[model samples]
Target chain A: MLKQVLAAGLMSALVAATAQAQTPPILKMTVIATLSGPQASLGEQVRDGFALAVEQRGGKLGGLPVEVTVMDDELKPDVAVTKIRGLLESSHQDFVVGPVFSVVMAAIFKPVTSAGVFLISPNAGLSTFAGKACSKDLFVTSYQNDQPHSVSGEFATTQGYKRAFIIAPNYQAGRDALTGFKSRYKGEVVSEDYVPLNQMDMQSEIAKIAAAKPDVVFVFLPGGLGINFVKQYRQAGLTNIPVLSTFTVDESTLPAEGDAAIGFYSGTNWAPNMDTPANKAFVAAFEKKFNYVPATYAAQSFDTAMLIDSAVKAAGLDHDRLRTALEKADFASVRGSFKFGVNHYPIQDFYLAQVAKRPDGKLQTEIRSKVLTADVDPYAAECKMQ
Target chain B: MTLLVVQALNGFQLGMLLFLIAAGLTLVFGVMNFVNLAHGVQYMLGAYLGVMFARIAGGFWSGLILASLAAGAFGLVLERLIFRHLYARSELDQVLATFGVIITLNEGVRLVWGSAPLELPMPDALSHSFQLMDGLRYPVYRVALAVTGLVVAGLLALVVNGTRAGMLIRAGASNQEMVSALGVDIGRLFRMVFGVGAMLAGFAGVLAAPLVSVEPNMGDNLLILAFVVIVIGGTGSIRGAFLAALIVGLVDTLGRSMITDFAHAVLSGPASSRVGPALASMLIYLVMAAVLAVRPAGLFPLRS
Candidate 1:
């Protein structure tokens, strides 16, 4: 009788273990960003914004635990591709986000999207994915490269800057910026200058611009190059010519340029001082956490997190269902309202802002005017989403 | 015409900065036979320290002095701890070790300052524009940079030609064994030379910080140009570095600006726009390649 009882107990324990094994551990999701490189600031902002959204959602998505994996891509396209591939393959990440440069974004698009894994681009918006090569598995929480610059051109024309000299580094993005600007502005371009991407000295270019004497200068220099150009432009006494730029004079650059950035106009999709309650709260929380004002990159990144959270909550955590829900556009963003266009780019407003001294005596950007309200990116016309 | 003059002056200023960086790199290579990739990181450290000092001292001069001193001290410590080990090792080992230092310093700066670029403000005295000619005004600060670079170059030339340490350095560059055999303390000479070389690079960084963004990886791009300058100038020759740096600065700056314009005149607007930047960037490398073809040992190779 005792031997019979022991066999029954052992069988019961085995049965319980098998049942637990059959039920897989609660679905966990991992979000990763490119956290090192020249553009680490953008990656960090996105990471912060995404984390804030997760916390606001009580640290869970779709009633299941979620995890975020922040990895450094070092801004190298190849490194980004390799690191992202490893993250997706080795770690079994439910979703992936970012590698912010368009070069890197384009590099990794094929493998990540072909595998049917969801990719949410918080900053980079490469034109190829937004048009002929649009993917069902891809969604962009950021504006296309052409959108803001197109609006900038229109705004410059409206301000009576008929003769404008355009400048950008010699790169795909640089060519795109000039193309985007020209598409909207019908005025005569006085001259277009292309400098090397890593070219730091701008004196000769500044001299040439002075010689040309254009009514205004529109530039698309990003990161360190932008800071160098703005200072050199001022040093060259070309400040008398109103300068209008895209991605050249934003929060990412404001701290570097200090008062030199003042009075220049920058066109972007989002700014920290946006007058929405969500944006206000976001800026407050982010500043408190990071001890600095968050740039548009950070705001968009935060929205990307909220975007995933909303989709995951609305449609159970099954990968396909969550992707479908994300496509439905159920989340309210800090940018007031954002909906994905047919091209997988955001249909959003673009604002013209001036770098000005705030009440706090520190240099800050203030929205001078709203250029477009719910702007549909031009690439959408080319997209064939049914 | 005045704009042309200003642009030429600007080019000269840029060349001077390049010379400051290249002079040290070439000297270390010629004498110590060290391939130190972290030299650029030291320049970056100088900029960061300058900004920090400015913040602490609340004055530009004080900050500049402190930053140069600090950078020199940091270089000494680095030599003792890291660079000393690699000096006797193979060139490949030295390259690897210095590259490691670059990575560590780049990441270290990121951790300490965060990824955001910091601003180093110009002093109140150097903030205004000075009118040199009719309808032409340039920032006083840039003019200052040019003057400062010229003065440093002059001082360097005097030291190299007239001082005991200079004799030792020149002798060490030609024959390290002979200098050591002649009762000169080779190790002490090397340490002093390394310290001075590092200080020159650091001073350039501090001077540049106000004009450029103080961010991580700021020096890497400049570092490449400095290498080009060193190669063209010939190793261990301060005068060669100065001349080569100016030539490079002028060519690069002028080529980038005018190449696109020339392209536009010859080609269609869009086509020129596409081809201009790409070609202009290749100009410097092409110059370097051409120079190398003509003189593999460089234009002014040190005479043993």
Candidate 2:
């Protein structure tokens, strides 16, 4: 009787081993996003855009079944570090995607990459990471922090604006914006002002702008600051002077900005009205599924998923093999004509977008014209990536 | 000169809004001896309520009135349910408890209103800009906001200084035990003060909503400024709060507008451009520190 019982256990073990060998290994993923607070909508776009790609793939990426865990960073760097430390100890993930804020990105990048796991930032490509600090394990699907602003700077020059007024919040990102704008525009900056970060009031600043009387105004205020600035700018009767910005008037803030953002110009990598089949489908499916227009945050996150899928298919999750495959970036991007620089940041076209009310009564940015063709971040030359 | 005048008007508008918020904060802190850190949440709730009521009523004026009433009612509910219990506790406990209230309400608004900002459209009559000079134009809505704040200030002054309740409130601030012993319903008086204070904050929120983005924690920065106002003005003294608000406002606005130019005169252009705005941010806090050094009890201390 003992011999028969042993024989049955051995047979069962053999059968289970064969079954496991026949099936693909499951991929584990963790998404760290700002899921709460004022910027939650941006994080939601990342979450939803990634989820849509996964759902379309029937819960698999590159012939492997996948399990995804989402952690809310709450837009706090300290909190994100703590959560990431816990994640590293408790569970091993193949990929960590997310963190919409640059502050949170700076916090979580080291912990995730030091653990030998790939960290993909769908948004918030801080210049700090794109330059001398570039890591093979860290990938950014979004443009470097300055690229969009640079697009506006170049566009301003093309529009024959001889003098420009620039303003941004006084922070690292704000300084980056000024540097970016200065790098491209040949025009003279009449005035540059940096207000306190999170300052809701801009009346004094607007008065200064009125007094300066520059041909164009460039601002880098995002989220609620953008809403307040745009509304007040319109109210100040400065519509005659064109306002050029990036991430200031986008799908995320357009609902609150309302008519104030109409005809306002922003620089971006992709807009919903792009004339590509994949982009059109993605936009339609996104709006249908999420009940709101997809922002560039969503588009970049979607491409991040597609990047993973392509890389996994080529190299099958082996650490070095996957790194090589990701560097290749063998996939059709929703933005069209996408490639990675030597530093693993995106090399793509930048467009000038204008906010327009769609026929369906929803406001979205439409592609006005392509401003940059296959632009690479200026910091790519500083990267020593092998 | 025109630029300076426009900036001054901006400062005045900001000052009036600060006054409305500080007025409520001073009354509660002064009369009840309660440190109510959640006072800012009342302003945020006012903005949220204004947005909601505007959507429902389809007009800015109706929304403003309804939101003010609702904010008062909500404040009374909070007072009766959570605050009154902590009134006699230590200041630290009141602070910790009210701070928790801020977190809960901030999260509650995110859950209910979602995290996106909601805007209150400018009323048509006030949407247009009025020319201040040859090239400078100011928004009519902002001018109207200052006027409304002045009117409210006038009414608040009358109620707090001239009426029977005002006398009772002054007595309560100086000595709550004596007022309670003299047969006044101190609990009822506290509740009334709390509600009225909340209503004033809400009124400020409604007025400022069109000019600013109405989102969670929108009141936080202004709350800190309001605290500074009350501290510099002398906590519990309404007149002190009014003067301090204006002083802080004009100083802050003008400082922001002219600091870079001022620095350019004294220093190199590159150094001044970088240092100017940073100095402007520190300007108000520097003023607060200066005031505290001179008068530890604040500009207008209530005799206790």
Candidate 3:
């Protein structure tokens, strides 16, 4: 009876070993974002880009299969904190991406960093994270909040605009944009306005801005608010005054502004018109898959996937090794050359572009010139990251 | 001084647009006692319809008329099929049902128009800037909007105060059961009121479309402001809605523009930069709260 019992135990051990050998190793990834509200389009674009990249890489990262799960924070910061915690503790995801808005990113900062999961930001580079609170686990592929605004301010100042009016929605990004612009712009600021985040009416404010008689207007209204501002600004006869902006005049907003956007100036970290071979390939692949041109948000998301793929390849998908490899910067991005600053935020280029009519009669934007190249963000010096 | 005048006119024009939307919301609530959250969706429908009509008809005026008519007809069908069932239900139930309608409509718009903002161009005649005074120029379309809103407001006042149908509506607001028992077809009256309310909201939307990008959730933000207007003015009075809407529009626009400068005068630049926007946004909410505290049923409540 003792011999028979020993034999059965040996057989049971062998069977368990065989089953374990057949089970594939999991590379867990989590996509956390604001899935509802006005910014849903941004989230959807990011998601599609990431999915397309994953499929192109054959659903594998560095030859190891990956499992991706997406969660919506509903644009609420408190909800984002809890959701990130749940993803780390229960889901055991090795990497977490997003919480698209800067406010939401700030909310989830501690939970995500302390948990030691790789936090990859495809968009929303909050300044605070690029400062004293920086973490090695947190990496941002997106432009720093101040990057585009700073370049835009420089361009406007160079254009001989001695006095400018600044307008933005009353939100974290809005405040940052104005601050970023003022930091670089030596010109006199005549007036500053902060409209409600979703304000649709701007007649009174437009009147006040006209009264101020600023040589140029710099506005940072994003998404639907951007569209509304551009349309109303044109109708209020503010079009003749050069309008300089960051988020207000992107491809995502150009369609809505239509002909009103023509002749306006904008600055961005990335554009579809970039002449890099990688960019051309990315645009072709994205257009073939989605049937529409990829916006800046989509490009950032796709680059994030490539970044992960490079890290995985370099480190063979082992969680600790992959994290270290990502931190060491193993990827070549479509944005030409980008390296993480000590704060894990990108040090990259920003371009000044103009909204113009294309040969096809559609209103589109063209990159006029590079405003800042390989620019290190202002907050980087404040970061004490090892 | 000319710039200030232009700004004030702009504020007044915006107020007029808000009044158009609030007027309809108040009428439906006052007469039918229904909290129709989907009223904003009706406005969105009007904008979308306007775009569609413009694409088909190839002219702005023709598109505006057809879109308004289509939106009114759509409202009638919704009243018969959905809203009529909830008149006897609780306000919460009506709110939930209307919210569902909003989601469906918002998503439906995305499916139909894609997730891009549609641009509606003004006619060539209205595109140019007209000088108001001393080199201050404003868009002609905005001036036209102000005039149109005033005319509509006048017609609304005349219909509510002078016509037989107006008397029935007043009586219905005062006592619905009495109007129903007086051998009147209350169902037809409710349907007509809903339709008219929808038409007014849609007309405002179409008029505003050329000036603003027509996008999903365009009505949602406006709807909140309109509710604030109705709550401050009183639920049933058109005059109250108009006054409150103008007040809200002016305060909101002026406060946002000047708050930073005002704060800078009292505090350091850094402090003002930090506190200005936050304080400016809180001002409107504070006004709404103060008004509510003084008059729990609103500044002017229609008898219900």
Best by lDDT: 2
Model 3 superposed RMSD (Cα): 4.3
Q: lDDT for each of the candidates? A: 0.82, 0.91, 0.82
Q: How close is candidate 2 to the true structure, as a TM-score?
A: 0.96
lDDT of 1 by residue, B14-50 (tens): 9989988888898898889889888898889999999
Q: Show where candidate 1 strays beyond 4 Å.
A: A1-27, B133-136
Sort all candidates by TM-score, best to worst: 2, 1, 3
Model 2 Cα shift for residue A188 (angstroms): 1.2
Higher-DockQ candidate of 1 and 2: 2
Predicted candidate 2 versus true structure: per-residue lDDT over A118-236, tens digit per residue: 99999989988899999999999999988999999999999989999998888888888887988899999988898998687888888888888899999899888899999888888
Go through the candidates in order and give the clash count of each.
Answer: 1, 0, 0
Ten contiguous residues minimizing lDDT sum, candidate 3 chain B: B129-138
Superposed Cα deviation of residue B29, candidate 3 (Å): 1.2
**DockQ of candidate 3 compared with the true complex:** 0.52
- Minimal lDDT window, size 10, model 1 chain A: A24-33
lDDT of 2 by residue, B1-304 (tens): 8888889999998999999999999999999999999999999999999999999999999999999999999999999999999998999999999999999999999999888788889888888888885555788889988888788788888988999999999999999999999999999999999999999999889989999989898888888999999999998899889989998889899999999888877888678878998899999999999999999878989872
Give lDDT tens digits, candidate 1, residues A4-89: 99999999999999998787445444445567766678778777877877777677765556777777666787887787777677
Better of 2 and 3 by DockQ: 2
Model 3 TM-score on a 0 to 1 scale = 0.91
